[model samples]
Target: MKVIADENLALTDYFFADLAEIDYRAGRGIQAEDLTAANALLVRSVTKVTPALLEGSAVEFVGSATIGTDHIDLAGLATNHVEVTHAPGCNAQAVAEYVVTAILTLQPERVQAGTDFCLGIVGLGNVGSRLAQLAQRLGWRVIGTDPNVQLPEIENLSFAQLLAESDAISIHVPLTHTGQHATYHLFNTQTFEQMKPACLLINSARGEVVSEQALLNDIAKTQRPVVLDVFEHEPIISRNLLDHLALATPHIAGYSLEGKARGTQMVYQAFCQHFKREASKQFESQLADMPVLFNLKQPLSTQLLPLLPQLYNIRADDQALRAGLNKDGMVDAAHFDYLRKTYPLRREWAAYGDQSF
Candidate 1:
């Protein structure tokens, strides 16, 4: 069977080796003609899979190698008999690590042990659950606010309570428009006003989850630090918000090599299950040739905070975005997309977990 895939997807060769023909194209630039003759199509969040894109196509299956399915029109695909699949929880660890990095970047003093430092997780799904575990391990009290999910040890509070108590807040929910608990514009002026003045907000979930205009106005009044890895209209982001943010990245919180590879494998297996074909288990890559050693003079107990920078410095990513601004002093759409396409290889934190301090 012929398969058309996103060129930016990692390890495409390992999964599509047995296919008749594997056509790779830019995700946002993929045309309807590209899918008109293909049997299957694989894409990332950048591609918008709608009825308009598949109206006259022979595409029977559509797969996205990403955790969120907001970009895919599930109802439309189901009505047209086009099976859809997505990779959920594949990048949970990567995003969790990114949250930890963001927290440390925003407030290093809060990284110390104690219940005084509390972390509020918006959604207790895959990414948020992992982050809660990490923060708990680092000696922070974790309070989650997902009505549907409840953990034994973690305290599940209401949104208002979470805003009032949490020293730092990280959003991990999906972007739902019509649901009773809609996440779109969840963090508006009132929500921002309710948060503690020093509360640090980190959003790695979805851009539209928080209202950019509201946030821009709210931050001016509250002086709250906001870190965003996703935007509402990606590639076409607001310069006012970008300039106001304490930390900003080009939506790459889950771009770790292992996370992306697992995403590709999950979608490929889903495609195989749809076609009743044997899936390959050759998901391997040479992204990391050698171990990244971190040498510190302090005790291992006091080394975690200092060694985190060796693993990944989020400031570099923030700087890259600041440097890619357009001539008009706004973020360039092409430059934003270019940063993601040519992102540096980042291995998950688990890669160096076995190393001695």
Candidate 2:
């Protein structure tokens, strides 16, 4: 079998090289012509997988290495008899840790997080649920809202209640436009008004889930700390927003080394299972020792402040993105894509010594 896959997918060759002939290409430019001779296609969030792309192709299966499927037309692919599989919750640990780090880093140093510090989570699925677990472990009361699920990490609350009660909030919902819990622009003027005046807001999930205009307006009024990893128009982010944000990253929240490896492995296993073949590659072999620079047993204030920055100075990502966007004589989109394509890989907290973090 010959499989056309995204060049960004980690371990694509390591996992599939022996099993099938591989054709790796940039995700954004992958076109219908590329799949004409392929038996399968593999993708990431940047690739749009629709029936039109599959119509005249020989591809019978499509695998997405990332957690989100917003770029794929699932129903259309299914209708066309093309099997599809995605790695869900693969980057949950990475994203969860990112939320924790971002929250503590963005909040005032005077504010010590103890039992009373409440973290409101919107959409308690993979990433949100993981964040809830981390918050409870780190001694933050977590209140969540997810209208779709009957049971969540904690008893679910109304979206308004979560906004009003949470000292800081993190968003982890999918972007939907028509459902009852349609998250497109979910954090608009009305919802933003419900939030605590000074509540910290973080969005590592989809960009459109929060209305950029409404957020810009609300933050202008309340002067709240907002850490954004994703933007509405990804490659074309706002210079104005960058100036005001506590931290801004180019959607690298889930780019941890372990996360990418796990995602690639998950989809590889699924592909092998579907084809009734044995999958020999294991992702753990790709993991290495995480450098522990600070004592975890030390006080959270001093230890974490030094430790998180050593492991991941999120501000560096902000600076890098800003520099890339403002480069002389280059398009913002090109710079943005180049930054992501060449992002320095980071390992998640799980990769640190087996001791409790």
How many pairs collide in each candidate, listed in order?
0, 0
Error of 2 at 282 (Å): 0.8
- Per lDDT, the best of the predicted structures is 1
Error of 2 at 150 (Å): 5.6
Clashes (candidate 1): 0
Expressed as tens digits, the lDDT of each residue in 224-295 for candidate 2 is 899999988776886787877888888899998888988999989989988888988898886676666545
Pick out the ten consecutive residues of candidate 2 with the lowest summed lDDT. Answer: 348-357
lDDT of 1 by residue, 240-351 (tens): 7777999999999999988899899998898889989888574664355546453344333255677777778899999998888777768888889888999985888667
lDDT of 2 at 71: 90
Residue pairs whose backbone atoms clash in candidate 1: none
**Candidate 2 regions off by >4 Å?**
108-111, 150-155, 291-302, 327-331, 354-357
lDDT of each: 0.85, 0.83
| Cα error of candidate 1 at position 125, Å | 0.7
User: Which pairs of residues collide in candidate 2?
Assistant: none
